[model samples]
Target: MNIYFVRHGSTEGNETDQFQLPTIELSERGLKQAEVLANRFKSIPIDIIFSSPMMRASQTAQAISLVTGHAVNENPIFEEVNRPTAVRGRCKSEPEVKEIMKIVKSTFTDPDNRHSDEEDYFQIRDRAQKMLEFLSKKEERNILVVTHGEILKMVLALVIFGDKITPELFYEVKRTFVPDNTGITTIQYDLSFELHESGWYVLGWNDHAHFGEF
Candidate 1:
């Protein structure tokens, strides 16, 4: 099975570097980016599409579905990491928000620590595991999923490092591998390697060459 994960396109909050609200919709450039991304999918054989229920991700998935001729399945498991509600729609540059973010980052060393309503390291990690398990059971050979950056990062780290993925390490991976809007990430799973391997291989990550079309 080949899984293609796409980060949702940009929103107004993205342009302003704010902690976006779940209900936020994509910006004009983001919509165009999604269209460009879908155009690239014309050459790939995608059997099914899945998306986080958030508006930005759903809109991005819908754009791809139009090109791929596949209906999108909205799944909450693919939603962005549950961030503290207080930061929603707030600019990251604000001193208070910065302090809150600092506290949040400091808590990364503790898997169960939570500053507020945000998802703990362990919870998000387990959710990533569940997502992989869900994909393994699918009959489709090619699957596409639209999600947010943070959870996408979590998924990649969990797939590549598995049990060795500590909270601290995950933080670094998240920091170093920032995914762009509409960037495509691909992972492959082969049944033959199930016995001796995780059966998952990172074929590609954050491929956004289609952005050149804009």
Candidate 2:
């Protein structure tokens, strides 16, 4: 089976540097990025389409669906990790949803203050593993997933390379596999289940040839 992992188009949060900004919508450039991706995959026969529940990913998936004619399945499990203060840390008072958004934005911008009360790395890994396990059992020949950057890196690295990912490794992966707005990563999966053989094998990463310059 072949699966395509795509990062959503650029959002206001991306322009301003935010982590898991749920309310942030796609920018004009972002919409164009989505269109470009849609055009790129217009010919490929995508069997199933899946996206994070967040608007950014959902919108991207919808745009792709316009061209591919595939129905999108919204999956909350694919949503970006929750970084709300109440969820992550011991807070004196519960932050308002907007306040939580601010905190998440701050966390991404200021890495020095990141992980103060962040979600456990293992939790993130386990959730991603569950998704992979579900997909492995599926009969779909071609699947597409639209999700966040960090989660994609962690999941793809674990599934493809069998590497023990560290913070440093995440940084390296981000640098090496920089997915532009609406960038696509393609991976081939083995039919038979085996340790090294059954997991993902990356065929292409950060493919934005569909989009013209800038």
Candidate 3:
């Protein structure tokens, strides 16, 4: 199975470095990025299209849907990580922002002791695993998933490595593949169900070739 994971385009929250921006919509550049992505895969065969319920992800899926003629299916499990109440407030200073990130990273790494109010990492992993399992059973060769950066990272870690992801590992993966707004990452899954044996390879990451480097 060929799974194409796409991170939603830039949003006002992204520019502001906010975590929980449910109300933030896509920025102007994000719309253009979506169009570029859509045009890039206009002719590609996409069997299924899944997206986060968030507007950013849904809008991105809509753009690709127009090109592929596939409807976007909502999957709440693909939503971004929930932030802790203590860290919900927007930070003004650099040190405050760093503190918030530290808490966020802690929440991501420790599921049991996650923030005062946040979904456990285990829950996110299991939900994403179930979705991938469902996709694997299907005969479709191509699947498209539009979601947030954090969710995409979790899915990739679970599907590609089949192991609990540490913050260090996630950071390493992010550094290796800096997915831009509307960027696409293609991973080839072998017929084998085993993640270690599966010939999981990154076909592309943050590829904006369609946008002409703009």
Q: Candidate 1 on 118-139: residue-level lDDT in tens?
A: 8878889999999999999999
If ranked by TM-score, best first, what sequence of candidates would result?
1, 3, 2
Candidate 3 lDDT over 45-164, as tens digits, reads 799998888888999999999998989988887777666665543643458656766775666757676546766666666776776676667677899988887666766776546665
Runs of candidate 2 with Cα error greater than 4 angstroms are: 86-117, 163-171, 191-195
Q: Provide the global lDDT of candidate 2 against the true structure.
A: 0.75
Estimate the TM-score for candidate 2: 0.78
In TM-score terms, candidate 3 sits at 0.82
Per-model CA lDDT versus the true structure: 0.92, 0.75, 0.73
Model 3 / residue 84 / CA error / Å: 2.2
Candidate 1 off by > 4 Å: 109-113, 194-196
Clashing pairs in 1: none
Candidate 2 structure quality by residue, lDDT tens digits, 127-171: 777778877777899999898887787777676546565655655
lDDT of 2 at 90: 30
Q: Residue 139 of model 2: what lDDT?
A: 89
lDDT of 1 at 56: 99
Candidate 2 local Cα displacement, residue 29, angstroms: 0.8
